[model samples]
Target: MLIDMSVTPLSADDRQRYARHLALAEIGEAGQQRLAASSALIIGAGGLGSPAALYLAAAGVGRIGLVDYDSVEASNLQRQVLFTHDDIGAGKAEVARARLLALNPRLAVDAHAVRLGPSNALDIFRRYDVVLDGTDRLAVRYLVNDACVLAGKPLVSCAIHRFEGQAMTYIPGRGPCYRCLHPLAGDALVPSCAEAGVLGVLPGVMGTLQATEAMKVLLGVGEPLLGRLLVYDALAMSFQQFSFQRRANCAVCGDNPTITRLEDDGEATMIEEWTPEELAQQLEGARAGSLLLVDVREPHEWAAGRVPGSVHIPLGTLAARATEIPPDRTPVFICAVGGRSMAACRYFAGGGRPAINLAGGVTGWSAVHGPLPRPEGCQS
Candidate 1:
């Protein structure tokens, strides 16, 4: 698909604005022109989308769409850098659109403050050339992927944990879908940014990569991440790429195509909440050996009075140490306040492992079980 860059001559403003891009050998005038004609829809306005949107707007993408149902919270400021304390309590998509437009008034930014689900995904995505999945939930990730496949649009997906991140691009026939790599969501608890905690700069790295891939696809300049997965370890400061093949039996994009329609995963809804009383019951069950409790909190948190006999495996380590979890027992996950455990539960449940959430988490556990005992040399 050779782009006719000469058709749309750069305006004086664009030439001055993208002077740096015109200087690059790989992305000269033609690439910049292509970018100016591209349209992209980003699905999250939080951490990943924040950077991705910012970079894309600055790069002169012609049209950008933002979708998010959440409101900015004080907690989101840690990594959702696009929002400010003043923006807290405001809709994420609304705030993001205002900010991006202020940064580049020439670009078109459409902000939709509604949740993107199967009902609206196709209609919302059909308007854009590429869809970027910045959402952190497993079910939503699958929804975005399948929708992209069904819409025949490309998807640039990225996920982040505490110190690690992963990214891949799905170009329908040209590459493998997300299911091809993670065929089954593994039993290991997938830590979330909220539960496992993330360095403020981590999403900046991964989200920027998502933005880069989107721009590359738009400009048709570099090889997109088709059929490849990029994994990054901040602690080790290393990046690795692996080849992934599409699964012939994939339920959605597979040869048989059994899933012609979208079905919401009920487990995703169950993992999102935990009442105080429910949390207490789960903790009691853990104490009596009625349930196998898995603590995916930090080591220091465990040392500071974890449920007795509960095994500690920080969420970041859960993926690499899946064998450590005993398959004979029904696992119940616990995090500081339940968010991370929910993410972990979703990953496990999606992988065919039935796990329960320890509502209220350890914070609630300590309240009912009495103040947690502070381990020696451990700061409470």
Candidate 2:
């Protein structure tokens, strides 16, 4: 369906502001009008949602609904570019709504300072034309997918870890749902942002991609990421696309669907709970030669201030270099904060290796051992 860009009815001010868009053959007046008529719901306000929200607002998306229950923190300032230090302790959705409106007052921005769950997802999503999943929790991802399917909405989902990110789109009845690619299991362990440690800029790249996909879906131009996984490697500066097919046995969107109704997998909770003191003792043991410390933080982080004598194998390189780690040693994993290290611990534990997570990670290590020297090129 080719839209007539020149024929879009726009106010004088809107036409002047979106002149660049009007110049594009792919997205002219008709595409801009389509954007003006669409509504989208973004399900998180962290890293991914930050960029996605900013772009959607700037692109003149008619109505945007933001759903988040978190408050801004100092740590979030590193990647959530939409907020400032002053916004800390403020509700992310509310603050984001204010910032987005400031960028484009003509756009309608709705802020819902509540957590999205099975009970509320369908109703919230039904009001929008597209749904974007920017959440980091697994249970929420599943809930968003199910809700989108139930509402017959297209879902644009993205996830980031360290320097890697992945995104896919789920269009009900037209393409595979998230469950088709990742079949859920009772014992399957899902990594949380608090336990996976994502790079600050990683989400920016992936989130922008998601925004691009959403724009394409809205304008009905270009191919959406349906049935395809877009993987990004920031360190190597590479992008890889993999194709997937709908699973007939998918429990949710399958032919004989088992999950016809939305159900909660329980409330969302941060993974890995350990105090600073407990984490210190674990690191001390590793330094005492009784245990091996595997610093899963990036190479630069290891050089900054790692446990006295720890092996530096970045988490992204783990799968390929797993053989380098001796199976005989009891591994104690560490990362910038604690997220990535805990994920590393789980990965090793599942592989039959006795692995322990260093709570609070290098951040906690620095508090106990004094501030260590920053590596040459390592950014704080």
Q: lDDT: which candidate is best?
A: 1
- The global C-alpha lDDT for each of the candidates, from Candidate 1 onward, is 0.79, 0.78
Over 4 Å off, model 2? 1-8, 190-196, 264-380
* Residue 155 displacement in candidate 2 (angstroms): 0.7
Question: Which stretches in model 1 have alpha-carbon errors above 4 Å?
Answer: 1-8, 185-194, 264-380
Model 1, global lDDT: 0.79
Model 2 lDDT per residue over 1-380, tens place: 22223334789999988999999999888778889888889989999999999999999988999999878878789999889999988999999999999999998899999867666788898889898999875556877988888788889999887789999998777899888878765223333334536789999998899999989888878999989999999999999999999989887888887777675332222223344476566555654455666778766556667666677788877767778777666677777666666666656654656566676677767766778665445666
Q: TM-scores for all candidates?
A: 0.73, 0.70
Scored by lDDT, model 2 comes in at 0.78
Q: Give one digit per residue, the lDDT tens place, for model 1 in 1-380.
A: 23234447899988999999999988888878888777899999988999999999999998899999878877789999889999988999989999999999988899988866767888898888888998876567877887887888889999887888999998868878887777644523444435547878899999999999998888776899888999999999999999988889986678987556544444544443445466556556644454567888887667867765577778887677766777776677788877667667776666667777776577767766777666456664
Score candidate 1 by TM-score against the native.
0.73
Clashing residue pairs found in predicted model 2? 5-29, 5-30, 195-339, 196-339
